[model samples]
Target chain A: MRRMLKLLPIRFLSAALIYLVAGITLGTLDALGYGSFKSVHSHLLAGAFFTLVIMGSMYQLLPTIIGAELKHRSLAEFQFILANLGFISLAYSFLSNYSFLKVAGLIAFISFILFAFEIFATALSVKDFYRRSLAIWFFLAAVVYLVVGSAYALAGVLGITSFSAARHAHILTLGFVAMTNFGGLYELFPMLSLKKLHSRRLGEVHFFIANIAAIGMFLGFPERGNLFILSSLLFLAGFYLFAYNLTRTYFSKSHGPEVEMDISARFMAYALAFGVAGVTAGFTSATLGFPGSFTHVHLILTGWVGLTIVGAMYHIVPMLTWLEKYSTKVGQEGVPLIQDLYNKPLAKALFITLNTTLALFAFSSLLPALSIFAVPLAIAFLVFAVEMLLVLGR
Target chain B: METLDVRGLPHSERPQLILKKLEELGELEILVEVKPVPVITMLESKGYTCEAEQSQGVWRVKIRKKQG
Candidate 1:
């Protein structure tokens, strides 16, 4: 049972890396005008990379937050296997335009349903739900979005709904990925900074605003009018609330000198700032109805979601590995902080390159000549993957 | 019995605050009002024996110095 549980986080992270490579390769190809693999790229980014990574983190986090064992361990193991297989099949089916790959969608859908049940079964078991942290609220809400988003994807796969790939991408990316990131930020910002979260009230406000914006934009994007602009404003507002609360918390008095304030913490702050820029870009794209509207989505995906995840893994991977490896050595030997697990200079370089790549990608839509950024972006991801592997090696 | 309620704390601070209180209390018998289930292992690792029960929608955990 314990073995099964351990497999989850590792497998999820591994799969996420694989998906990231695939997603970036596909994106590079599309940018270079080889083929418009837009749907495949979105699926790999939203489904394979983000969703899998978030789910993996939840497996590690939920039990710790609730102070209990996760319910349905066996179910989770099965879901893990099924989800990976389903994703591969689903991606292949979409990439090749094979109708047979629809079965993969069904399998993935079942996996998500099982995942929702796993989350609720574990989370709801807590006696007092109200005392649960703000992160739990966002995490549970993300689960709801996941179930809903997966259902939407299934419908699209089955041809039962007119839900376009673009709409599904927004729902899954914002509704699932961004929602999870928000919840994760609430917990991680404090943990990494070694300070309590600044304000629960503001966090609550951020949650509602972000969710409203996500749902509203998902529905309003097609119309591209007042609703879209309003939703974008709310989204921007939500990002602002998070930025304020997190920054305030980070600078608030900590117990002591914070554990060297790793590159992960810096990355998180950058991601928050990027989130603001992305939302602003989104608003501009919506209001102007620009010919290069795709830039906005690229900004959000790479700037907000991509950077945040890469940054988070720096802390998360080391923390988990330490628990597994050096936990007992603490108080007995000179145990290193989680920050020491990874190369800081590499992390900073990755952050810089990633942002530069996103900026170039964002402009590439406007000027196809800017597509030369693809090589640098690919190199950034390669550096990131190698750094992550090195961290795990330690 | 002294009681420290972690209900109002953020998730990140709850465990830290609880651990700090336990360290300060040292040999005293204290009732920690927390989610309880999550802190049991940590408490046990620190040489404290604890038993938790839920009452009125909150967990009440009784902790004392471990008997040799």
Candidate 2:
């Protein structure tokens, strides 16, 4: 049961590493006095942390979800080491402003490309609609976007692009990372909640539309306002449909949904809505410019992306660990459910406080008066750390 | 004596797993209609009621009576 706990550190390692790096970077960038080191952190979070976690979960997820023997276990085994090494080098490069990160990115890019090829071959080998469709849709979209986005960033690194390098960062973060994770969510979440999904049609709809929107917006930015607007609308619409279906799944189930779902799934639903708000604001707020851009990234990262990852962790951790065996055993024998393993009150407080702090951080002019917001957000992380430790049984 | 076809088995799953699960629970001789990968070819050769076929990643199996 506890074997899956190893996957925990791998996932949380990235999460914590991201913030730790971001905090240092932000402290360094405080001289600017407006936005922090978000521009840099966006790339790090999307490329390194998000990339690592998604790959890890997919290893855990693809086989279980699709009921297929992993195509090459040896390759899967090596992928973890290769990816993390590349990520570490890339992060170091970013911090040191070294050319080596490009080399690291190249290594990581090769790993990703190979990973994508393996997933494609593995999926095509499957004979089931649910499994194959999910594998195909999931790996294909995730890999394609990630590859292109990474290639673009790598091009920037090679000094080929005329634009600011940050543009590539945006494409990688928003286009590749977010699109991939969100697509996986549609397949993963309903199963976690023990409810039937609304429609595979809607699933495909969300997948294609969001990808098209992201790709179109990326390619057409600054020159094609109409295209960007249309793309943003499609992205928002896809999210809305996804959230709606997830909500229905959680609520529709007769076997009262798990505490994990209650906390994570519902939070993610809010995050999706928050994402819509953030994107729409960016579309309309040329007055805000870069800040508006950061706002959108924050919403997707902290709101939608962060919420989903956290919620998914709660479910995936226990499911893979075989901890659910204890619950089912306890249930049949008239014992309590697995609620004892978690601290709900602490999480609730973190949710409320963190949500408020992020909102203030993004939408408010109160930084002058409420300059103390960082303390609470930091406190929220403290609480999160505690709960996370409890989940890990630390 | 006759074969009946069932629909709505999502188009991508392995037909054998479906058939096996159904065969485990149901009381009928497994008959093949159509499938991409048929599980038991010997049954088909014996002129058993079941047969399978595959089209566009979808498999359908049918069941009928033996010829005598």
How many residue pairs of model 2 clash at the backbone?
21
lDDT of 1 by residue, A292-381 (tens): 557777777777777888877886676566445554454456666655777777777788888877777678867887789888988798
Candidate number of the best lDDT: 1
A8-33 in candidate 2: lDDT tens per residue? 33453435444444543453344236
lDDT of candidate 1 at residue A269, scale 0 to 100: 77
Fnat of each candidate: 0.12, 0.00
Score candidate 1 by lDDT. Answer: 0.75
Question: Model 2 — TM-score against the truth?
Answer: 0.71
Per-candidate Cα lDDT values, in order, are 0.75, 0.56
Cα shift from native, residue A381, model 1 (Å): 1.6
Reference-based lDDT, residue A104, model 1: 90
